[model samples]
Target: MSANHPELLKLSSPIRCKILERVNKFKAKIEFDGRIEYAHINNTGRLREHLIRGKTGFCLRFEKPKKTKYRLFSIEVDGYGALIDTWIQGKAFERSLDLKLIPWLKGYRIIKRNVRLNKSIIDYLLRRGDEETYLELKSAVQRIDGYASYPDAPSIRARRQLRDLIRYVEDGGRATIVFMIGLRDVIGFRPNKDVDLEIHKLLLRGSQIGLEIRAIGVYYDLHRSSIRLWNPDVKTLI
Candidate 1:
């Protein structure tokens, strides 16, 4: 990895597989080693554009046996990998924070995870001196023509979370929303206006307020079973 791109912890060596079909938003049937097995899909987006029937991808087997034996981790799109697991976004961002790889949020230390305030559960709570910062993480998997977009489907929960972040800012605390783009080739990110107009408008309003909005691009290499930061300075395309 270069100075600008930091490597994330590899969970497990990925197994080469092909997606047979999407069982639902949270599950899929995949073929690996000439056997068809049902696996868990962590991403909730309507990934119709990426999760095609015969598309090659990578999956990780469970360390211990569970309801699902495998989890679809990443899929190759146009020779570039797109991470499909939403759970990895927070882990990657937290690792970056610990290593001080993020420039703007370098000195802050994470005090808590899954912090609850009012009705929403923010992703992290950080403190630097007497000031506190509440942070939320959103995983972006939908990409179009080198641009990444969030919320492939309508998200009322996302809207509520934004409202709570705005309130936190209004009450004299710092708040930030980080969009983690999972597509390797994305140059920038923006809210999906066609899918969720309310979220698009809310993101604009939140940016106008004191809520800090940031984005970073990530790349997952199935051949190496590794993840790394692709773009350190992701632009806000709003």
Candidate 2:
């Protein structure tokens, strides 16, 4: 397991709030300082287990006006905090790469972000000498009965990305699918077969063909209002 990055530990503290109601999958009403406001939920997962009434969570206020006044980024679940922001996953992965926390990608340099390849725009394209690696980051927020699962909702796009990665591997190129588990204290990682069976199978086949599949656990520090790497060696159930 890798140590936490020092720079990431310096983020400003978050505002403590109580979840009043879930307006929908992407918005929620929260209470802080006796004032109620609707905040944009940064995660797309069906977080029925976490964002419930009376649950304490953290919200980051925006300095400028936008679609929503605030963003709910983390929620307390069973005494542990989960980082629900999808954006944080990408940032954390970049930091991890910079720190050489991922051993396999140690010497690789990020050549581009959102690199267009075939029918998909991958999250990153890394290069080292003559080798090029394509990487995609998927935020995993749904945890059930001690297991963390990806794509809380069915996504054809997720499957498409997997196919692209598989093709890249077939062409003698390297490809990686990273599942950044946004929650802490998960026993293992797996594809949500009940929600997306095809993705689950693709992951299995991708692993068989040298497509690197990794699951890293990430959690929000309530005291720091920052996301940190929780587990570097999170088990992959698949």
Candidate 3:
């Protein structure tokens, strides 16, 4: 990790807003600048901690025409901000990779983005020498008991991808599953068994079957108003 470029990504036209209520899985009502409006929620996870009423949220104001004028990116967590936007999390991960911040993937280069394998579209494909690895990134914004957790709700898609990765590893192929821990104060990352026991079981099975499991932390610093790469190699609890 380079000392000069610590902040991985900066928010675009960010504004502080108060979360009113989550209208649905895709939309949330927020109050900002003395006005109430709907903001697009990019994450599908059940963010029970961040989406509370009156909780402060950081959002981006989009100039282009869209369904919602604002998009919720991060929410206040113990005076700091916890990034909740899935898109922003992916962007931060890409920036970290480009800067060679992730130590585990030091010699690897991204060959493709959103590559299709079998029936699922994995996040990235990397090559280092003759070895090729299919990598999938999962957002772990749910913070529980000083650890970053995944799938605040049950996700069939995530479960299917886990199965596919496990099978791919079994068939003499290389695969890696990375959990993007989007919090500043997490000790480590782990699968949320309480939310989805099957996912937890599948992750355990995948790790046991030679699937490379890794974790990286990317979080938003409210005081700096920029997204920072908290840790390039966060410990994997599972």
Candidate 4:
């Protein structure tokens, strides 16, 4: 099938030397747990990864992926695992998006693929205001110059999520999307229009209508297995 989005400019591969170059520069310790668990603390989360870096590290952020679906996130190190968050990989960014953005959900339910709804399945199910919700997570990897963008790898599933959310809104259901920007050096999350314009248009429409589109900043302390919002204002790039 023909793609409707603009082609993003070429950049370094995900697993390329650039990754090791960045990781090796860190003098901090490593902390990452390969096992995935159920995301119970938040409504839009399914699993959390424990840091395995000899006890100390924090996430720095993530760069573009060599491919889609790898939990190939970047982290910072200091001494030992602290906040132990992040699970799975490619789809994990979506949860961090909600945890950082959705202010309304101070204490809500986060379930793992409890039930399949439509064409696209959300990683987490959030229940709030008596309505069962679906959520999808994405890692912010691609960027232009200094601008951070989504779909570090092209995702037909992502487009499906957008369409599904559009349908959810039409059906009187609540839905929100989180684009977790793992990069601390960047500002906000923008659609990689070069990669997916349909998604961009749908995202714009979702924002205009009822969909909650949020961009959460990540403060990675890989050595401590911790990530926090370093900025008060979560930026959203249209």
Which candidate achieves the best TM-score against the true structure?
3
RMSD of each: 1.7, 2.2, 2.0, 13.3
lDDT of 3 by residue, 103-163 (tens): 8898898899999888788999999999999999998988789899988999999888888
Q: Which candidate number would show the highest lDDT if scored against the true structure?
A: 3
Per candidate, the number of residue pairs that clash is 0, 0, 0, 39
Residue runs of model 1 more than 4 Å from their true location after superposition? 1-4
Better of 1 and 3 by TM-score: 3
lDDT of 2 at 94: 85
In the range 123-229, model 4's lDDT, one tens digit per residue, is: 67877567766766566644566665765445677788889888888888888776655455665668878767788889988888788776654444432333444
* Candidate 2 clash figure, as a count: 0
Higher-lDDT candidate among 1 and 2?
A: 1
lDDT of 1 at 140: 87
182 Cα displacement, candidate 4 (Å): 0.8
lDDT of each: 0.83, 0.82, 0.88, 0.49
lDDT of 3 at 85: 91
Error of 4 at 236 (Å): 1.1
**On a 0 to 1 TM-score scale, where does candidate 4 land against the true structure?**
0.58
TM-score between model 3 and native: 0.95
